[model samples]
Target chain A: MEITPTRVNFEFNPHVPIIMDSGIFKAIKSGGSSREQAIKSMYEDNKFRTQLSKYIAQNQGNEEDTKDIFQEALIILDKNLRNGKVDEDQNINAYLFKTCKLLWLNSLRKNNKIQLIDFEENPEELVTNEDLETFREEGKYKSLQKALTKLNDRCREILVLWSQSYSMKEIMKKLDLKSEAMARKSKHQCLLKLMQIIKSDPNGWED
Target chain B: MNESFYTELLEIKAQGKLNPEQEALLTSLIPQGSDLSSELKAYHLAKQAIEIDISNELKFKFNEWDQKKKSRLFRVDFKTISIAASLFLFLSVCSILWHSNQHFSNRRIVNDHLHKFNTEIRGVNSGPETLSDRIGKLRDGLEQNPTLVIQETQALLKLSVTGVQKDAIEWTLALAYLENNQNEKALTLLKSINANPDHSYQKHSKAVLDKLNSNWRVFLF
Candidate 1:
């Protein structure tokens, strides 16, 4: 006797758990085109900029200062997101405002216009100390990127690809190398060269 | 393991592509006290740092937007500056007009005091050769022939006369000096008359002195 197979239909439920990769955190994790879209959307959104500008203006800052602080805050935010220092559910606007406020305060401190202890009191509970540490790490990354530019095109290409997590086999095929060993050796030599360059200019990595 | 072998393992480990056996092998090869651990850490940091890519296109977009905002602000600043300049000019013009009117009014008061003195001289009538007649002659020639009035007033003052006649002769001499452009002599005579409390021309002299002293422009016109 032949048996007929029954069709099992599953209805969509609103309460069911769905993984949505729509937020800035997920976009940054995805990198490439998605990361660009996320950054563009965040930049074009006037709410964050307006709030940040208002905060900076109230704290002895001008329009130009606001622009600088906002741009820097956006870059730091992007870096922190990419580094997994920011939580997925964190409010991007609030995070940006706090970052801008801290950056401006830091600038004021650097200029001797404010005491460090004065702005440190009652720090926002939303931005943890770890998040602030990421800002400093972001500076180091900037210096590293600057050092990366001094290398030859071939070295930069290999190092960039390696840094992007391309396997040895993939890197060798992409760069038309003879073998994985050659790719590894080239990557190691390029890194060593990069380190040498960084060592030559000790002050370059101080940031 | 050799340097290249360990570096390959470390790179794989950084990429999170190492299997359990490879991870164990890397851990066993590079002990915690080994210098390769620091190398691995540095390699990881460099990888993470270089992965942060901020596109130049985004930076260019932001700079373009900033330039547009700055140009807008500059346009607003120029308009504000123009309005402020216009206001400053208007206030300056008004101030000048007000000062000119004040100077003109002061000059008119001085002229009125001189006219009152002339009218008083004309009102007084004694017969010919009297102090009143001599003062009348001085007043008549005060405008055109002040030199003759000065000479005659000096002659009249040398004679002993009544208090009223003395006051009239001194007043006429002062006016003659003023008409002859001898303002120092005129001011001296007027100050003397103003210092005398019982003199009949004391109040008129004080008024003319006040007007003359109020503004130097009064003397120019």
Candidate 2:
């Protein structure tokens, strides 16, 4: 069955100036814009999804990679691709290409595919913002998500019960603890196991 | 001593029961400051996530590792591929030079025709003409002058802030011609209002571009 998508989204990378359609812009700027509005506005406007997805897929990436790329691009664009510092106009494609190229190039540098020396640069690239709140949020969320995935099944269950604000008495019956003391003991042990896993993988979390 | 101590610490944290001394003692045992309760909170969350799914950690929608290995395979021939690419680039350069040679003669022939057009048009259009016609005359002036024409064309394509010379694009082109003593071409370009408004050329350059399109030796050159 064919599901006809009823919206325009995804344009090219923002470097090439591939001119945006005016109609979509109107929908994006529709009245009463809040956080909820912007999320929905994604469907009604923001026509850059297909191009971005295709680029990732062509590079042998998947939808998950596509999502990561999209999110990272969003954060970086908000951080860097603004203020008319670049030759940005209404051309979403060109703007996307420029931003996307920077992303791909930076990723390449991280992966050792490209050099990091002064090939090209702007002063704004360095001092855009001191706090990368969006990136940090994603990092914290993803770390928690990943650590949860790495738990043993029993440890996993106990953690879940404890997280739901389950009391020691409730957990004692559910996890078959001998007493509240046992459930408490198991919960702490389970939590320590998770912390150990996280500590092993700590990249930015370390002081 | 350590086993029961660690166990009691876990139990004390688990039941949400802690004597002040026990809590203080637990804080000393854990190396990451006294955030034992917070650590347990985060750990509990991760455990819940695992209970939901293990594929969350170990699974990918695509054969990512396999694809990465394939890309790695290509790295084996990096030197050979670079050499091959360099050779291909050399051959492509040779072909372009061969092609440009063919285009050069065509450009020269076109320049000759443009020169003829310059001389003929100068004879016509005596007085105040339409705005569009003046623009046309200016284009004709710049075209007759090779230096001015090249500079103007370069500016147009340079993709810089200075490229858009408001209305003086033709005048700049005209200046380029005047500098090269292509007075006839400069005369045509000056006739255009758009050409006159370009800013890079000096007043002298503008005067030279606007000087009567005559056949006398441009001794200034």
Candidate 3:
């Protein structure tokens, strides 16, 4: 059976378990191999793919655009989950769809390519306060990426792992640290250096 | 709250392992409306942006798409092809050879200027260690490594030196740059020398510029 966007049934297939109902969020929060596995499953899921394709088709978007928006939405969702911003009662699939749709609309409005009818039929302003928040988030993400390039390769790697919520034991093993303490110290130092660099740059945190 | 407290709170928040009591304490200490809370959220977002890796499936798909695009762009049907492409390719090769010959012929004039500068006139040695010795070394170095001579001459120009000494170094550097196939840099230095009325090498620079401006073989044959 071809999976439709609204088809919530995943119990028939014992091979690929469903990532609905906060399961994927919990996997991502757990970090390490679990997060990687969760992301891979999401990407390869037929239902998820169909949902993305359906959403993109409605908005005059292509496969490439759909893939990019889906990936970005996942990252934002994961960030929100980690920051305790996501409501516990929210449905993951619906949340992902809505966020991805808004992101695409924001992108269209940003490039001024949205047709007059598209805007008129919607009636509400496309450039809402939420779009402004997304814009600010994207801007900060860009600045953070730029600042990351300024760091040493080793420091950057350590911080990346640390940011993903890797345990000190895992970090020690990965980086060949002498002990968990060494990993902790290195992570702290690298994180501090990154924060200092970002804070010093006015663009990273605008007044 | 202090910056350190906020930093630690952000680190803990990013880890997503805060217990209920710890979470309650954090919420009580730093309210949702506080800038510190906003900063923490921003840090978490930045961390997420950095840590998240794209899936291998996406990467493989991108590679597949790229290869398909490249093949589509370069695909040609031999039976239905025109001879214009072959003719264009042949003409392009001939044009490139002609341009390379023109470049080499122009380089010969610069070589001649170096030969004349080394043999006919002597560099002023009024400064520290005799300018003639340095020029001789640079000339010999040029024979082996023109790029090295260019760098050495540029360094010498940075030194605090007299009028005659500076002009001598600048002129040599211009020649070195020309020999290095950097015609624009050579033209710039030569123009500066020619523009300076007090420069001892003004006449020689103007003469070189005139020849360079005229034709590739103006000074030769």
Best by lDDT: 1
Model 3 agreement with the true structure over B1-221: per-residue lDDT tens digits: 24334446666765777777766666665534555556575565456335432222235544565576557656644423546678788899889767646654546656767776766445345344566679768876775677999989888877866666677788788888877878899889999999999987788788878777865444332
Better of 1 and 3 by TM-score: 3
TM-score of 1: 0.44
* Candidate 3 lDDT tens digits, A59-134: 6678888877776676666656654566656667766665676677667666665533323224442223343243
Candidate order by decreasing TM-score:
3, 1, 2
The candidate maximizing DockQ is 1
Error of 3 at A83 (Å): 2.6
Clashing pairs in 3: none
Could you tell which candidate, 1 or 3, scores higher by lDDT?
1
A37: Cα error in model 1, Å:
2.3
> Ten-residue segment with the worst summed lDDT in candidate 3 chain A?
A7-16
Model 2, residue A17: C-alpha shift (Å) = 18
lDDT of each: 0.66, 0.49, 0.65
Residue-level lDDT of model 1, residues A1-207, one tens digit each, is 333332211111222222223477777655555666677666656655665566666666788888777777776776677656678887665566667776776676556554443233455555554555432555665676677778888888787666444668878988999999899889878876775566455554443
DockQ of each: 0.15, 0.11, 0.10
Model 2 CA lDDT for position A161: 56
lDDT string, candidate 2, B65-89, tens digits: 4366557878868878999999999
